[model samples]
Target: MGLPDYIPVKGSITFLGKDITRWSITDRAKAGLTLAWQLPARYEGISIRDYLRTGTKGCSERDLEESMDFIQMNTTFLDRAIDKSLSGGERKRIELASIYLMKPRLAILDEPDSGVDLLALREVLGLLRLLADQGSGVMVITHREDVAAGCDRSYLMCDGRIVLEGSAGAVKRYFMSQCRPCDGCEVGEVMRRG
Candidate 1:
């Protein structure tokens, strides 16, 4: 479902400079440009810090420190354990930090902030802005209004297709207008998942 075509059938997905649709999942991930699954993987013997360092080589203490602070602000479980002991929100942040460490030219995050609380969402939003500012094109697949609003541009998907493409404000207005109780409706509802 993370591929350009989410048809649930055999297909190809290219990432970074590689055409990974033909490669093994592990091989493709090593090439940079990757997806953080909705559910984070658990490695019983490894600590969170060690797990990150495993995938990101020669990672500076400063980078890890910055990432730790960023992850902690957005997720409370990162500094905790990975031994089936972390909460959903915590796991999500860990996965996000791992993805951020990959530092791909293009990042495709699917429902990146799904399990997080409000404060975490704020931190994630700031991080996304920072990534965009650093010249990375971020494609955030989310239903959250806050996520969409934080983006430089947004694409509205309906019926498994893109229904609208424009600045976030335009998309928000189109959604709000189509909804009932238009005048009192909260724009945030646009991004909320069930």
Candidate 2:
């Protein structure tokens, strides 16, 4: 995905056998590619239902219900605004639910497990698998062991570049070895200030 105010030094991107290396974000979207960012953006005046309706044009009530169910969301949230009023978990779930309904040709999920619980994480994985099985390409960028392990292959990215690419187990082991807590760092800090 292209980041705003920054251009890729060098890279080639192809989606569904089409070269999209120089395509704009709008163009990629028009070609059925979508990205689910790690931090879901909030919409000040948009309702959850309205936001989700963008996933599928003229979305029916039953389809929306099914999508919400797939993401383990309560249908009553339809009227809620897409803003800070919602919890991080709730926002993340809505984003995933939208992705589920979008049915894009390629869905790039960045940290799908960031704000989700065990069950929601499982649902996210299931959604990716379902998408792949249905002829869509799903790419998940996650650091969680369980999440990465679900993939057929995995790539370890370090310093904004790939350091390893192989079986999920191999990359997972390498990632763990390099994940221990260290002094003068907060990578694994979990306790409250004493």
Candidate 3:
């Protein structure tokens, strides 16, 4: 989606009851809206601690450590450069930690479950729930049943359009039933037939 672009188009985007469609990305960040990209940008020279501290101005050392702990990150990572040196899961966790520090009013995560093992996936889901509990609206885009299960509502999309929207369980059940593979079945064809 073009949400992070921070440019105006045909549609309007409202956050916290205000129109932010034309707001600059910096402005949106200042207004407590943030996005965690699926493949976060690499900061070759910036240490993890420096990067997170930049986002969490005035936060004490204990606060930073607690944020890392919430995401299950080892304290050692704080000294490492946020570059290719880190594993994919490590990078993902660090990106999520940034979100926790920013404490955005709304967070849009793009495929948070991708490339991570089951254990990391569970941690991501836990952090997402924590964000919601902390009053941030989380919008997760994922195809994984477990991720959807962790969400309050789920929307099934086909060809860029949502074909189903309901409680997570209902949407998952419907998707499983309708999209299951058969000898000659294709997803688009099955969707059309259904």
- Model 2 Cα lDDT, one tens digit per residue, 1-194: 31223357877887778899989988998798888887787766888889988767878999889878877778888877777677776777788788778777777877777777786677767766776776667777765667767777777654445667777788767767875543442221110000
lDDT of 3 by residue, 101-125 (tens): 8888888887787778888778778
Tell me each candidate's TM-score.
Answer: 0.69, 0.76, 0.80
Q: What lDDT would each prediction earn against the true structure?
A: 0.63, 0.71, 0.73
Give me the overall lDDT of model 1: 0.63
Q: Candidate 1 lDDT, tens digit per residue, 1-194?
A: 33333354654565655567678866765664566544566666666777777778788766766676656643333455577666667667677677667775666677777777787778776776776676666777766676777776676654344567777778878877764432422223222111
Candidate 3 or 2, higher TM-score: 3
Q: Rank the candidates by lDDT, best first.
A: 3, 2, 1
**Which regions of candidate 1 are displaced past 4 Å?**
2-31, 43-45, 60-63, 69-80, 84-87, 176-194
Q: List RMSD in Å for every model shown.
A: 6.5, 6.9, 6.1
Which candidate model has the greater TM-score, 1 or 3? Answer: 3
